[model samples]
Target chain A: GAGVSQSPSNKVTEKGKDVELRCDPISGHTALYWYRQSLGQGLEFLIYFQGNSAPDKSGLPSDRFSAERTGGSVSTLTIQRTQQEDSAVYLCASSAPGSNQPQHFGDGTRLSIL
Target chain B: ELKVEQNPLFLSMQEGKNYTIYCNYSTTSDRLYWYRQDPGKSLESLFVLLSNGAVKQEGRLMASLDTKARLSTLHITAAVHDLSATYFCAATQRAGGTSYGKLTFGQGTILTVHP
Candidate 1:
């Protein structure tokens, strides 16, 4: 309730199966971000949303990855036909409207593709 | 495209020792952020450096920014076992109203402090 919250802390799916990860940002936070981190790798930006509208999706790896936000509060990241390479920790963060504000992060969802 | 690089991908230090982690970016950015992540845990925001010469300190960690050099540093003072974690630095550049606040992150520095 006080910090960013992500659902399905751990998810295991088949290589071809699709999965949806959910993020509930801090109440009143207007900026939400999605990032993916592979094993022993740095975080890779996936997308960012401002008040239910994604301003930049360039960081998305491919067409199979998509995200959407509704009511300016909750967001979902969908991965279609997942591959083994897609296994990683998906992190969600939220911040205030200001550009200089520090982001508060969720515990992150660890996805495993089998 | 913005590229971020961090030096000393791994560090092992004795307790009470000090160290600094470096972050360099290829393009101009409006802000820099530092974060800490423990094993199997999500990141925790450590600092936000907004302008050149900006510096912020929390506990034993201090972060500084140099816009002209496109560099940022996280200095750890008197390291403790509790400070053992992975540290990351991210840079953000505003392209326009739509592409604002997108961050490009550096490969994290994994620090291990021994007692």
Candidate 2:
């Protein structure tokens, strides 16, 4: 695809189950970011990946949230023991060269915990 | 920590009307960004302001930055129904000349346009 891509556009999991969300950035784009948006709400930062370096995991809400980027391309965000509050849309975006550039986003994955 | 705030959480306007959205941040940043998100969709990049005096305009939207005030604004000119969406302002933290572009976003301004 010509733009950022995310997988499992919708997910419904048991309250205690775990879930993984995937992202594929645009080819050659070096920056990736993850964010969460509750229904009718704004986005909350999650994490960011620059090039192949260690990702900045600062925005992660808790220890149960983790993410990994391989070969500077694709990333996976994992959430453990999901709670009802984890219900939200997880968004992925990628930018070229620098972070100051415009970011192209993928259709977010809507996760619902029951 | 950087704190960002936006006002007029919701705005309803008719086509051809104009409005402005404000974004304020707590700390100094290297750049500011504006994005748009439609219903149940991901964000769409709208603008990037690199410096205090930076201003960028496209179509019906114009975005400006003021590092001194730690503020940014997105202005709409002759708005249309297609312009309805949630608008977000983001700031990037930087140390030295290099920045990782980890953006902290403000609560979005929701615009409703009726034609």
Candidate 3:
């Protein structure tokens, strides 16, 4: 893809249900990131992946949230047993090999927990 | 933990006016970035400040960074209605091996350039 791509641009689920958001990063890019943006708030870091390095998960809000990248091309963010507070926009971005490069962002998936 | 704070969380300005948005971080960092977002849209990268006294300008917007003070400023000159959007500043810090390239973002400043 010419740019970062995210799937299921919008998702709505009942509380306690699980949801999955997917991201397809730019080809050949080695760095990927996930962030959450609540209404009227700033972007909150969730996770980061740099090549084969174990993903940095220190920013994950809870154990219920986890992400995995397959083949270093596509990634998935799964929220288990969603809560109302989990409602937010999940954004994905990819950079060229390192953190020094500017990131290209996806349109993001807006998750709504009812 | 690197914490970032942005001032003037909400700004309503008349078009053609000049103003500045301020960002301050709690820790020392070498990289700073500015991004813009419209309502119901994704973020767009605007500028990257890599060193103290680094400055970058694009059209009506200019961004500057001061690593020593842990501060960054986004200055709007002769603002236009099309520039109405939320602006954010983020800082990158490498901590051990798990927090590399982790960007800490400050609360965004919602700017409305009114005619």
Candidate 4:
């Protein structure tokens, strides 16, 4: 089976521009999550979706960041007015519908703000 | 709020030696997870500890969790060059009906194994 897939493995954009990162979860995975990794911040959870509805969004850094999942399989994270601080690797993960199931991660999209 | 921390943020070990990475959480968690990531790569799930005494081993790596102490350990036995990577430990707290699968990750430990 194919693992989680992410598009635009690398994206370089000017500050204040908007960028959208996409994620394709594994087949039959109902739980999806977004995470960010940076040099200063090791790894941080951004949001979590359960069956198309996001139940947790507390991890989002600011109002400019938003994510949505459709059909419970694909998710997109959009960052508006990107800042130099927002430059990092955006990782998406998915897992089966279970309490303690481990999440499988995608290659991640590296976002760089120039 | 949940906080997870890992010690020895940087480790350099010799091949064939043994070492352990420690993870501690600030709150009670439903599960503990270990992940490995290579340079310019995403995380790879290593182990999931569900119980206080849960211990799992794969190849030269072993993981154990002590829920009572809110601690988890990833031990490398006879470290090899291939084990060089960043290791992360995450804890998830159960909320209401669904877990939501939100992970609180610790600062990763960068491990380097050399001959």
Candidate 5:
């Protein structure tokens, strides 16, 4: 794909089940970011991955959330023991590892925990 | 903590009307960005400001950054219904802050331009 792509555009799951959302960043982008947006709300920073830098998890809401970026190209956000409030749109954006680079975004996966 | 605040959280305007959204950050930063997101869609990059007194415009929208004051503004000129959406202003935190090389976003302004 020419742009960032996120899989499972929409997902529904039980409250106790674990779910995974995938993000494929734009080619050659060395930085990846994950954010969560509740319905009709602003974005909340979740995690970030920068080239050769330690992934920042300061923004993750709780211990139920985790993410990993492999080979600096793809990322996955995993939610463990999801609760009803865990439902939200998970957004992924990628940017060049330089300053002032415009971040490119994916459509995001709308996850619903029942 | 670095905080970003956006004023006029919601704006409703008649077609051809004008409005401006203000973004104020709690710390000093040199880079700012504006993004637009439609309902159920991803973010679209609108403008990137690199320094103080930087100004950029596209079609009906214009953005300016004032690094000294740690503020940015998104001005909507003669807004149309098509421009109605959520606009987000984000700033990169300084190296000394808790969020280094990380973007802190405002609460977002929901603009609804009625035609």
Candidate 6:
């Protein structure tokens, strides 16, 4: 893809249900990131992936949150036993191989837990 | 830990007025990025400042970075109604390895330009 792509542009689920958000990064982009934006709040980093492995998962809010990237192209963020507080916009971003490269963001998946 | 703060959480100005949004960070950073987001839309990258005195401008918007003071500023010149949106400043730390490319973002400034 020419830019980062995210699936399930909007998802609304009942509390305690699980949800999965997907991201397809730009072709050949070696660095991928996940971020969460709550209503009217700043973005919070969730995880960072370099290639097929994640070097930093420190930002994951809880054990219920897990993410994985395959083939260094697509990634998935899964929230297990979702709570109402999990309602937010899940954004995916991809950058070129360097740390200084600007990240290109996806449209994001707006998750609403009811 | 890296922390970023943006001031003037909300700005309402006339179409021709000028304003500046300020961003301050608590620690040294490798780079600073400015992004704009319209309501219910994704973020759009505006500028990337890599050095202490770097400056970049596009159209009516200009961004500058001052690493010595851990600050960055986005200045709007003769603002227009089309420029109404939320602006965010993000900083990436100098740490390499797994922490690379991780951004710490400010609370963002919401700008509204009325005619």
TM-score (all chains, Cα) for each model: 0.96, 0.93, 0.94, 0.98, 0.93, 0.96
Q: Lowest-lDDT window of 10 residues in candidate 6 chain A?
A: A95-104
lDDT digits (tens) for residues A1-68 of candidate 3: 48899999999999999999999999998888999999665588998887645457887999999998
True contacts kept of 5: 0.59
- In candidate 5, what are the lDDT values of residues A1-96, reduced to their tens digit? 588999999999999999999999999988888888885656888887885354578888889888888887889899999999888988998887
lDDT per residue for candidate 1 within A1-114, as digits (tens), equals 588999999999999999999999999999999999997656888999888888889889899999999999999999999999999999998988767688889999999999
Measured by TM-score, the strongest candidate is 4
lDDT of 5 by residue, B12-95 (tens): 999998889999999877889999999889999999998899999999999999888889999999999999999999887643
For each candidate in turn, give its C-alpha RMSD to the true structure in angstroms. Answer: 1.5, 1.8, 1.9, 0.9, 2.3, 1.4
> What digit string (tens of lDDT, one per residue) describes model 3 on residues B1-115?
8999999999999999999999999998888999999988899999989889999999999999999999999999999999999999999886454334778999999999999
Give one digit per residue, the lDDT tens place, for model 2 in B52-104: 88999999999999999998999999999999899989887772245455678
Candidate 2 scores a chain A TM-score of 0.93
Greater-lDDT candidate between 3 and 6? 6
Q: Provide the lowest-lDDT 10-residue window in model 6 chain B.
A: B93-102
Q: Which tens-of-lDDT digit does each residue in B1-115 have in candidate 4?
A: 8999999899999999999999999998859999999998899999999988999999999999998899999999999999999999999988558664688999999999999
The DockQ ranking, best first, is: 4, 2, 1, 6, 3, 5
What's model 3's lDDT at B39? 89
Q: What are the chain A TM-scores for all the models, listed individually?
A: 0.96, 0.93, 0.93, 0.98, 0.93, 0.96
In model 3, where do residues sit more than 4 Å from their true spots? B95-100
Q: Which is the better candidate, 3 or 5, if ranked by TM-score?
A: 3
Cα RMSD for predicted model 1: 1.5
Clashing pairs in 2: none
Give the poorly placed runs of model 1, Cα more than 4 Å off: B95-99
Interface RMSD of 5: 3.2
Encode model 6's per-residue lDDT on B1-115: one tens digit a residue.
9999999999998999999999999998859999999999999999989899999999999999999999999999999999999999999975465346588999999999999
